[model samples]
Target chain A: MEVAVSIITGLMILGALYAIHAKDLLSSVIACGIVGYSLVICFLLLKAPDLAIVQIVVDTITLIIMVAVVLDSSREELFLKPDTQGYVTTLTGVFLLAIFLYFFVISVQSLDILGKGSLRMAEQYINGAAQKTGSANLVTGVVFDFRGYDTMGEAVVLVTAVLGVLTILRIKGKK
Target chain B: MKGMTLIVKKTTQLMAGIVFMYGIYVIVHGHLTPGGGFAGGVIIAGSLILVTLAFGSDFLKLVKEEAGTTLIESFATLMFILIAVSGFFFGTRIFFNNFLPKGVVGHLISAGVLPLYNIFVGTEVAASIFIIFLSLIIFKEESAQ
Candidate 1:
């Protein structure tokens, strides 16, 4: 499982890099889709089927929208020659990434080993969750019951996003 | 934009129904399964997108969906809020309190209020996403003209 996770992560990085560098907008969008779909695989491998389901469908819809937009417009992105500023920006980005990676490794080492995470906070949720929520699926119980307010907030956020999109897309003055 | 071919259209006709039903199943069985409203809602939107892509969407049709989507999304959110707030009128007068009887653990009606939340949230999410897609399409059409 670890090996598969690592391999899929590698594939995701590859897809992301290609998406950033690809000249054709359509192919770039497809490469971005590859990254999202691989993330779905990662979610499933990590035993989060709920997230995987959302990721796959959301990724597909996002890909369709991106491809539609790209196809409607010009497919070819303007190619710019690598200048000194561009090289400096790339170096700064790589440096920032290395710093993040260093901290990530440190954090991983300081954490509990895999499969033995401390359930100090989740103990109650894990023990009496089935009886308290009266739901077979604990995740949904926690999401809808124990954390119902948070769920409502999430729904409100989604609604606000849609409203923002519609408002922004509306015509200026007349109808 | 036009559809691909006859074969694609025929395949979509058979498959979109299955996808739509699967999304409903996910939302209905949310308390008993790994999927819930949000995932199911996105899946439902996906089915709609598949149909729109395969058969092609019309300008007038999108306008209707746009209006209905906003209304349905608002309605679902209102229902969800009402259900949550209605808890104040029920046992313990607590917000989002489980006032309904929790059936058998594994049964469809097991969860007190989770299923209702899932159903309402499912509709809200589906309509929101569908409207976003519709708006994008309509924008494209208007821009093209």
Candidate 2:
């Protein structure tokens, strides 16, 4: 299972690279969807169902939005061409991936990224949450409690994105 | 567009509605399940996009952008702030701490301000994402033309 999962991840990384180099924006968006789905599977295999669901849902929305944006902005070109420096980019990417995988392998051996309290002041929520707030999901408890302010800031970011889109698209006396 | 035929569109449209309802279930039962505000909320927005793709902007007209989107956005924000501020009265430093009342762990009324915050987050995320998609779809179509 691990080998299969790793192979799938490798394919996904290749797809992502190809998408970045592909001249077609729509195809790139499709590749992004593939990457997103693969990541969802990876998260599921890692025993993080919550993160998996979030990734799938958020990625679906983002993919659709991006495709729509690109479709609006760009016309279909007659020919498709890969980047001229694709070999260089691929080598650089592979180098980075190897470095990342090395660090990830070592860290997974020694540390727990999934372990709670990875962030500063995270222990405050992990330790004090259930007793004080009585929430079941530790992540939910941390997000809405210890890091409530941060989540609020995230919400503001979403709101601001909406506002920005509206401002950019607004027309005089249209509404 | 190439692979998505007419039958696929019709089927996906129905699936979107199901997904939307499922998202609401996840949001409401967030405390009990693995899902919560953010996950469920985005699922709801995903369903909206499906509907948009299948039926186009006319279906969205039923919601009326101002009342459905903007109003929900503002109201959700207000509720969140109120819950946070009420924590101050109980002497907690930040939001939703003291203001929330305690109940059974698995019960609907439980989780103090946690569940309430989930609801607010669910609404805020759902409305904002839907609004963003709507504006983009509308504007992009115009620009393309």
Candidate 3:
């Protein structure tokens, strides 16, 4: 498990770096998709199947939207001439990266091991979910019943996004 | 965009139905399975988008009109709202309260208002995605012309 996690983490970093450095916009999009899919795998390895499924679908839709946007726009080659400003930007980025890495290592070391952390809500959900929601799938019960209002909010957000897209794409004075 | 090669068109024709049916299966069995309305709706939209890619926008004309797609989306959203509001009249007067009887656990018709919510959400999502894809494709075509 540790080996798999380490490999996935390495791949994710490689994908992000490739996405950042790729010259072609389409290739950059594909690299971003690789990073997104690898994170879905990481979610699955962490025993969160629901999250994995949502991530995969959301990733696909995002990739589609990005590709459509890229296709619709003028395909101009992005030229980045290196200068003093570029060097300073690169140095700042590296410094930030180092700081984040330090904090990340500290946070990982401070994390509680599995089965050691407080799980009050998780325990209650596990023990009472079936009887309270009367649904066989605990995840479903929790999402659609226990947290139905949250789901409603999510649905409203989706509707708003669709509406925004429609408004943006609407032809002036045309229904 | 015109239709693709014969092989691609034929393959999509064969696979689209199965993909759509699988999406419905996922939505209906959401309470018993890992997939829910959102996932299943996306899957269904994906299958339709695959057909559109293979056969082009002309194929959409045969299945559903542009205005009809928006209408369906609006109606599904309204249906979702109606279902939620019905809970107030029938049940504990709270919004989104599960009023219908929760049948036997593990059955297809169980889970009170959950399956209904899932169905409405699935419909709304599928219609919305279809509209989005169609509009994007039309925009691309117009810009190209």
Candidate 4:
């Protein structure tokens, strides 16, 4: 299991790097998609089916929208050659990546990443949740029932985001 | 845009419907299933996206009802807010209360207000995403013109 996660994480990092450096905008978007779909696999392997499902669908839609936008405007991404400053920045990025990876390795070795966390706050939800919410899916129960106000706010945020996009992009509006 | 070739078009026609059905399935069975409103709604939007991509801007023009999509989105949101607020006036008079009966867990009709929330939220999300996609197409056309 640890080996599988390490391999997937490596692939995800490679995808991110490729997305940054890809000469074609479309290929960059696809590489971004590889990162997302790989995270979905990571979620599933961690036994979070609900998160995996959400991640998969959202990733596909995002890919579609990005592809459409890229196809409409430009295909080839402009490439810029790096100078001394750019090289320094790249070196710093590599340094940060190594530190993060070291921390991640240490964290993954703990039992929490394997789904046996301390459950300080979640203890209330996991115990007698089915009876309390009367829903087979505890995540949905928490999302739409216990934390319903938060969910409603999220929905409203989505609506507002769409409204903003439409307002900016509308070809015509009311007179 | 004239869209892809006939093979792509035909394949999309056959597959889009099934994908849409699967999205609805996820939304309807939200309480009992792994996925709920937002995820399922994206799948539904994806099916429409497939159709639009396969058929091109001509198809979108044929369905010149972006206003109608906005109306549906507004109505769904209104309904969602109304449902949430209705609890304030119901049995317990508490805001966001589960005023309805919660049947056995894992049942189709269980989870008093979860399914309703899911359906309304699903509709809102699907409309919102489709509208965004539709407007992007129109924006591209307008800018080009």
Candidate 5:
């Protein structure tokens, strides 16, 4: 299962690379959606159902928004322009990719802090959560109590984005 | 061509309403099932997209300008934060620290503030998503036409 998951993830990463280089806007959008869908699958296989659910939902919304943005853009060189930015952008992209690949490989081999925390807390939460929070769902306990602040921050970030859009886009008299 | 599209539009409107109700069901029962804020939110957003497809851009304009989806979105966000902050006043050492009663495990009133937060998230997500699409459509139509 792990090997199959790895293969799928590799394919997804390659798809993302292709998305960057794809000449057509529609193809790029499709590739982006493929990447998001594959990531959800990858998250599921990693045994984080909550993460998987959140990823898939957020991803679908993001994909739709991005496609809409692309469609709305009037720029003729939407995807046809090759990178003309001297060596700066190319070098930056290569450096970032390499660093991300290295970290990704390292993360796969070891238990990161989050994984450790989840493993350590999973049993305790499962055993006592019902009595403490009166909730059957362990994921809910973790989200609403253990790391509720983080989730709240995420919601705030989302709201900020919405507010920014409204302020910039609202016509003068049209409330 | 335009006349043939009206039938398609009406059909999609009906479908959108059905889908929207399903999303509401998923959201309201989220605590007991696999669906929660994220899943239910997306489902609702999908339904809104259907409305766009069926009813034409005029419907979108009406919803955007008159429905106050943006205000709902903002209020939902504020309420979510306020609920989280409610924990701080209890001196529980951690925010959202199960300050209220959790109630019965499977009851509708269970999970302390979780369900409340979920509802807020669902509303924000649904409204934001609809607004996102509406803005894009408006931009495209204005620019292209």
Candidate 6:
């Protein structure tokens, strides 16, 4: 399991690099989709099936939207020649990467290695979800019954995003 | 967009119905399955998008005006909100209190308000995704011309 996780994580990093540096705009979008999908695999490996499902669907939709945007715009070359400020920009990026890597390694090492990190609320939800909500799917029970308000907020956010897209893309007098 | 070849169009026509039905099944049986409204709605939206890509935007006329889709999306949002508010008026004053009787577990109509919420969310998500795709397509077409 550890081997699988490491391999997938490495691939995810590679995909992120490709997405950042790919010359073709469409291929860059495809690389982004690859990164999203690899993250979905990582989620599944972590035993979070619900997150995997959501990630896969959202990833696909995002790819579609991005591809559509690319299609509408000019298919220009993604990376132009570096200017005089390139060295400074590269130095800043490497500095941020090093900082993130330092924090990431520290955080991973800080986690409980014995795997007893389950919280009290999670334990309660696991024990009482089926009985309380009468739903065989514990995830749904928690999402819809225990945390319905959060789901409502998510729905509102989706609605707002759709509204924003419509408003921004609206063509005047185009019925 | 003129769409793909004849073979792709015919194939999409054949498979779109099955894909749509599968999406509905996933949404309705969310209580017993891994997939819920959001995932199933995306699948349904994908099916619609497949048809649109195969047949082109000109075929959008058969589905009614874009305003109609937005209206359906708004109605679904209202239904979701109403369902949550109904929980307050019923058994307890708390929001989303799951007021209805919890039926037999592992059955189709088991999870009292869960199935209802799933249906509402499914509708809302499907309509919203479709609208987003439709608008993007329209924008692309206009810019392309």
RMSD of each: 2.0, 4.7, 2.8, 2.8, 3.9, 2.3
Task: Give the Cα error of residue B127 in candidate 5, in Å.
Answer: 1.6
The chain B TM-scores of all candidates, as shown, are 0.95, 0.79, 0.92, 0.94, 0.85, 0.93
Clashing pairs in 4: none
- What range of 10 consecutive residues in model 3 chain B has the weakest lDDT sum? B57-66
Scanning candidate 1 chain B in windows of ten residues, the lowest lDDT window is B56-65
Task: Write out fnat for all predictions, comma-separated.
Answer: 0.84, 0.57, 0.49, 0.73, 0.43, 0.73
Ranking under TM-score, best-scoring first? 1, 6, 4, 3, 5, 2
Writing each residue's lDDT as its tens digit, candidate 6 over B1-145 gives 6778899989998999998998899889889988888888888888888888888866556235467878988999999999999888997789998888898889998889999899889889988898888887676566667
Stretches of model 5 off by over 4 angstroms after superposition: A72-85, A88-126, A170-175, B1-4, B63-67, B85-97, B139-145
Superpose all Cα atoms of candidate 4 onto the true structure and report the RMSD in Å to 1 decimal: 2.8
**Predicted candidate 2, C-alpha RMSD:** 4.7
lDDT of 5 by residue, B1-145 (tens): 0122777877886687887887887677667666677667778988877666566665446444425877888888889888877778875766676677778888877888788877888888888777776765555455455
Q: Candidate 6 chain B — worst ten consecutive residues by lDDT sum?
A: B57-66
Interface root-mean-square deviation, candidate 6: 1.4
Cα lDDT of model 1 by residue, B1-145, tens digit: 5666899989998999999999999999999989999999999998988887787764237677778888999999999999999989988978999889997899888778889999999999999999898888777677777
Cα error, residue A25 of model 1, in Å, equals 2.1
* lDDT values, one for every candidate: 0.89, 0.77, 0.81, 0.87, 0.73, 0.85
Residue-level lDDT of model 1, residues A24-78, one tens digit each, is: 8898999998899999999988899999999988988888888878977899999
Off by over 4 Å in 2: A1-5, A69-128, A171-175, B1-17, B58-63, B91-93, B141-145
User: Which window of ten consecutive residues has the lowest lDDT sum in model 5 chain B?
Assistant: B58-67
lDDT of 6 at B108: 93
Residue A48, candidate 1: C-alpha displacement in angstroms = 1.0
What local lDDT score does residue B141 receive in model 4, on the 0 to 100 scale? 71
TM-score of chain B of 2: 0.79
The segments of candidate 3 whose C-alpha lies over 4 angstroms from its true place after superposition are A61-76, A82-110, A114-118, B62-64
DockQ for each candidate?
Answer: 0.80, 0.54, 0.57, 0.71, 0.47, 0.73
Evaluated at residue A133, the lDDT of candidate 2 is 65
**For candidate 2, lDDT tens digit of each residue in B23-104?**
9988887766788898999988888767667766544463366447888987898888788888877855755564666676
Q: Per-residue lDDT tens digits of candidate 2, residues A76-110?
A: 54574558698788799999999999998888877
Q: Could you give candidate 4's per-residue lDDT for residues B5-85 as a string of tens digits?
A: 999999998999999999999999999989999889888988988888898987567237568888999999999999999
